[model samples]
Target: MGKVTGFLEFQRLQEAAEAPANRLKHYKEFVLHLTDDQARQQGARCMDCGIPFCNTACPVNNIIPDWNDLVYRQDWSRALDVLHSTNNFPEFTGRVCPAPCEAACTLNINDAPVGIKSIEHAIIDKGWQEGWVKPQVPRIKTGKSVAVVGSGPSGLACAQQLARAGHAVTVFEKSDRIGGLLRYGIPDFKMEKSHIDRRVSQMELEGVAFRTSTFVGSAEDAALFGQGLSTVTPAQLEAEFDAVVIAGGSEAPRDLNIPGRELQGVHFAMDFLRQQNKVVAGDKLPGQTTAAGKKVVVIGGGDTGSDCVGTSNRQGAKSVVQFELMPQPPEVENRELTWPYWPARLRTSSSHEEGCDRDWGVTTKSFKGKNGKLTALECARVEWVRDEATGQMKMNEIEGSVFDVPADLVFFAMGFVSPVQKVLDAFGVERDGRGNARANTDDYRTNRDKVFAAGDMRRGQSLVVWAIREGRQCAASVDAWLMGSTTLPR
Candidate 1:
């Protein structure tokens, strides 16, 4: 409440960005965080609502109004403190999180919501620039040791939290680099790897050891399900660490079992994206799949599909098309029906804005190829109809509507199914019906003693912010289970 009438006086402002033409030339972050004044004005726009829906809407439940007030008062240092109280990685969420908090803002009922994400981006960027972001090394050491599998946002957050709570924490990553999904699965243009690198440096400073290129399973399991440089058996990990957490990503991509699935030039979106990320990191990957000089078709209209479009355009694809099996969402949401919740509406990403032919209410019947090479997709228009008996909508292909989408390359981005099962099998952990490791949110403990699961490995594929929240909560649970009490927050 620095200025009670500030909401009436200010308009929501967006972060600036590089022009698409200029940004497509390099695989660096194109968008810029708000400047100091822009951040202050944005913060001031947060109304003095009786209740803060933005906080609850955020996965981490960030203390939004407090930080907004501090930012409006120009108390940068305290603003950073309030920002970091709940979320460990504001910078990551600020950049990539599809800000649900903004959608639920009280001001959004009738006006543009407060620019919370932009303010967070500004605050965190400034915290780094001003050296306010520093390691919170524990003052006293607890002899208890813990091992965290995977090094994505969730794993990293959990490891950092436990390390700060005076437990010796070690993070395991199968890849040569630490960040599992963030290091590879995401395209460099969306978020440069340098952001992950600096955080790794900070975690190391706080005594959270990172073991890269190391598999934490049997040798046989390592060979079958892991791509690590070294192997550490589950028994060894169990005997050495006081507790263990399975926090890897949901890597089992939902596959398209069409005729040309085995054909060359047809690939899962992550495989295509990961290889490009490694290439951008200066790794020489021979026969790297490229959309350059090819007509590209990306299936499954989601963030993954949008990323493929952006990456393909950067690689000089001849043309790009995206398909969504479901019906198109409304261009604008009905606020009255969906207030304070995530709305179903068409979302045009920056990648889409760059260029893409997006089609909805369509499905690929089969992949069309020649000489074992993918050349096009045999697609068809479809309608969704309700089944009264089942109360579920079913797809009905429209007769005589089959068509071909010519393509030289195709990427399937239909989302993930579950965590890599071999890893779970190697650990002897049980699974839910959906195949995610069986665990409850209350304590995040698995059926096996000394084992816990969180993030995508437990809850299936979700947003990065949700992963961070789960990781934080899981850490608190692990801490409590080890010492019979915990001071750490969820």
Candidate 2:
């Protein structure tokens, strides 16, 4: 360890953020990265725990203590290497991932945990500035070809790894641009598209090919996400590539199938977010959905809902309110009881901090509207209790607790249910009971020959860090399948 007594001496320092008033004026990242000195101090807080729970807690299993020590000792080049060895995209995770690694930190038992994510953000940003993040072109070509569908984090990671291993890799994206959900589902304010673009350029130098607006399925499947600019049948991909990797994200959103769901103002959250992203990119969208000057009601208490709150505030909404059917978690979790694992607790995002009236234990009963236009939401207070015989939790509406909330616009941010079905059907891939592509982590191989699945497509909607892990592991699996052996890290 760089500093034996570091944990006792250094306090946890967070990345500073621009003021809410000033930041709301534009859709740009407001959180500032840590300076070198600040990052070193935060890195020094890593304790000499016998086993680093943060490593296990992190989906990509980042070497936390080693890099923390390296950063503390000013060995930044080594720290960057250690950070990139496990995670392909630390910047993406640093910006958006809810650090479960911090929750599982040994120091979190009593005192504040080390600011690992901030340190990671520092190391990677420094690497980029120093020109250390360059292409790793292989010396020998493997002569094998791989087709990776979807250009989100998972597909990008898989393609990069395979390309570095000397295989010809082509990434297929249905969207006009490369990044799948990261380019559209996430707001630009969280992370600018420039990050994705830079990586795309690096991957191109490493021998990966990107085929944007090219859906790797039937035309009908392409139509599911706005007629992909070009279409490639599953048969064509199978015939041309040695292996096919399904990294397409889970895209089927869960709908609020209640009365008035067909109202004019009610819309899925992604539809609102995708349009805003296009508008920011200088694309003119007729009948574009905007939160400007409207009382916005967002349903769902997850990250997507928080994104909606932030976007609505930026668009000059009159008021924003969020609803959650689940009861509110505690403000803080009991660390003694939940140490070494992610805890169930309340989380307030930057969007929530900006502005939002949040309510829990509430359910929408119906939507009240006029002439097919949404006007208000009829809601009710509900209680969840366990059924004696069934032993399953069920919701019961409380008597005389019905209420109505003013809502000129309603966004359903509940969550995604599964991947777009037509794509899976086009590939003749079997699905798990949960609707994700059926594939185990050990091999990432799908039921079909020469086909594999990874990331959100295989595991359902999940964190970006998890997608990177799946991509790396799936790349190794594909390499082994093609060459009979592989040295690529999982």
Candidate 3:
């Protein structure tokens, strides 16, 4: 850890951000990384807990204590090494991750946790600025080729690891550019695309090839993916590469099939988000979906919904209202009961702070519109009651609580169900009960031979950290299968 008595001397510090009024004017990262002295103080606050629960809490099992100590000692190079050893992309996680590791910190049982995320953010940003982040090209080539489908975090992490292990790797992306959802779904205000571009360049130097606008599907499913995507049959990939990895995201969003879901102004949150991201990337999207001058109603209270709020506010929406099916949680968690676990509590994002009216236990009954264009939403209050036999909370509509929310545009952000079936169908891969690629974390292997699945495709919707963890483990498994043994860490 850091200092022996550091926990008593320092307080948790959040990364500074541009004021909401100013930052909302444009789509760019507003949060600034911590200064060297600020990061040192944050790192010094890491307690020397004998049994560090942050390790297990983190999906990648990062050695938090080691890095915290390294950073406190001002050994930035070693701190960067410790960070890169576990997380392939710290900049991504440092920016977007919810930081569950901090919640599980020993100091958090009483006082605020160490500013682990800010320190990590500072370390990576400094590494890049100092040119310590570079390509780790392997000494010898394995001569075996692996094809990775989808260029999201999981696919990218797996490809990078495999390439570093001397295997030839090619990443196929269906979008016009690399960085799958990272390049589109996430708003630029949260993380700019330059981070991904630089990493892509580094991966190239390390011998990882990237193919964009290429879909891994048959002609029959060609019309389903997109308009201008070039189709590549799964048969072609099997014949060309020794192994294949499916690391695509859970693209099938859980839709709200309300009475008037087909209203013109109603759309999936991802559809709305992707269009804006594309526009931000300098692409011209005719009739682009925007929240400008509209009363926006976002259904669902997850990260996607928060993003919709942020994007809507930035686009100058008349008003933004968010509805959540679940009831509100406690403002503060009971640490004695929930220590070392992700507790249910209120989490307000920077987007929520900018401007938004949020409601809980509200259910949308129908979409109200005029001329097939959304105009308002019919909603009802709900109460969660415990079932007598099942002992599970069940939502019941509250009578006479019906209300109308005026809206010009509505977005459904109810999260995703599973990966798109077209790719799995193309590969003839078996799916689990939940429609996810049937693969155990043990080996990250699907039913089909020479094929593996990781990330959301294998585990359904999950955190970015989990996706990276799965990607690394899957690469190790692939390495072990190719060679009798391997040195790659899981």
Candidate 4:
């Protein structure tokens, strides 16, 4: 601990966001960063807890105390090293991660926890500004070739680690560009693509090769799943690469199976998001759909749904409404009982502040449309009650609460179900009951000997930090399996 009483002296300070009025006009990052002195003060707030539970709470297990001490001492260079040791992409996580580490902070028991995410953001941004971030080329080449399927955070992290471990690593992405979901699915306003571009440049300097628009499966396989992409047979990858890692993300979005699903102007959230991302990258779509002048309704009250609200607002929608199936949570958690643990409470995002009508305990009954275009949504408010016999909770629709809402466009943001079955089927990998690629967290090896899996593809859809952690550990497992020994850290 740098300062024993620092936590008592300083209060948590987070980054400021742009004013809702000014930010809605553009699709750019609107977060205002803390100054150097403020960042240092926040870093010093790390308590002298005997055990650092914050580290464990972080997916990559970042050395929080060490970096906090370094920042407190004003040693920027060393802090960056410690920060990068665990997280290869702190910029990504610092901006987007929900900071479960803060929830697990010891200081959070009573007082406000340290602004760990803000400190991380400051350190990484400083690292880049000071030219401290550079390529770590391996001293020796192992003369091994590895193929990493997908170039999202997991695939990119795994490929970088393997390449640094002296193996020739090649990453395959089905998109026209690298960064599977990061390049496409996420909106540019959240995280600019430039972050991914620079990392790609650094990875290339470390001897990792990237191949875009190369799908690793047969045409029949692609057609079976209707995954629109050119297919490269699995046998070809097996022949060319010594070992294969499947890091393709979970792309199977949970669909709404209610009537009128096939109506026009109704779309999955990803499709709407990905297209906007592409547009931001200067790619033009002739018939691209826009929410401009339309009354938009977004179903699902998660991050993705928030993103839709933000995007629709930016696109100049007439009105925006969000629906949540579950009952509305309390604005504040009972800290006495939920201290040091992530509490289930109401979360209002920046997008919500921009302007949105949010409803909870509501379920969509059906879509009402005419001439193939959606016009309205039939919905109902429901109540959750305990069953007398089963003693389980059940949702019961209130008979008179049924209603209709005008909806020119509807977006389903209900989250992902599992990884696409095409690639898994190509490798003949077994799946769990949840349809996630079945692989132990310890080794990450699939049923096929030379095939391995990681990230959202192996585990279900999760945070970017979790994907990076899985990728790094999977690399260590692959390294040990290939060379009979591994010096790489998990």
TM-score of each: 0.98, 0.99, 0.99, 0.97
Which residue pairs in candidate 1 collide? none
RMSD values, in order shown: 1.0, 1.0, 0.8, 1.5
> Lowest lDDT 10-mer window, candidate 3?
218-227
lDDT string for model 4 (325-361, tens) is: 9999999788888866788899999899999999999
106 in model 3: Cα distance from truth in Å?
A: 0.4
lDDT of each: 0.92, 0.92, 0.93, 0.91
lDDT of 4 at 370: 97
At residue 466, give the lDDT of candidate 2.
90
lDDT of 3 at 37: 89
lDDT of 3 at 213: 84
lDDT of 4: 0.91
lDDT per residue as tens, model 3, 1-490: 6588888888888889999999999999999999988888889998889999999999999899999999999999999999999999999999999999999999999999988888989999999999999999999999999999989999999999999999999999988899888888899999999999999999999999999988899765767767877888888898999999999999999988889889999999999999999999999989999899999999999999999999999999999999999999999999999999998999999999999999999999999989999999999999999999999999999999999999999999999998989899889999999889999988999989999999999999988888899999999999888877889999
How much is the lDDT of residue 428 in candidate 2? 90
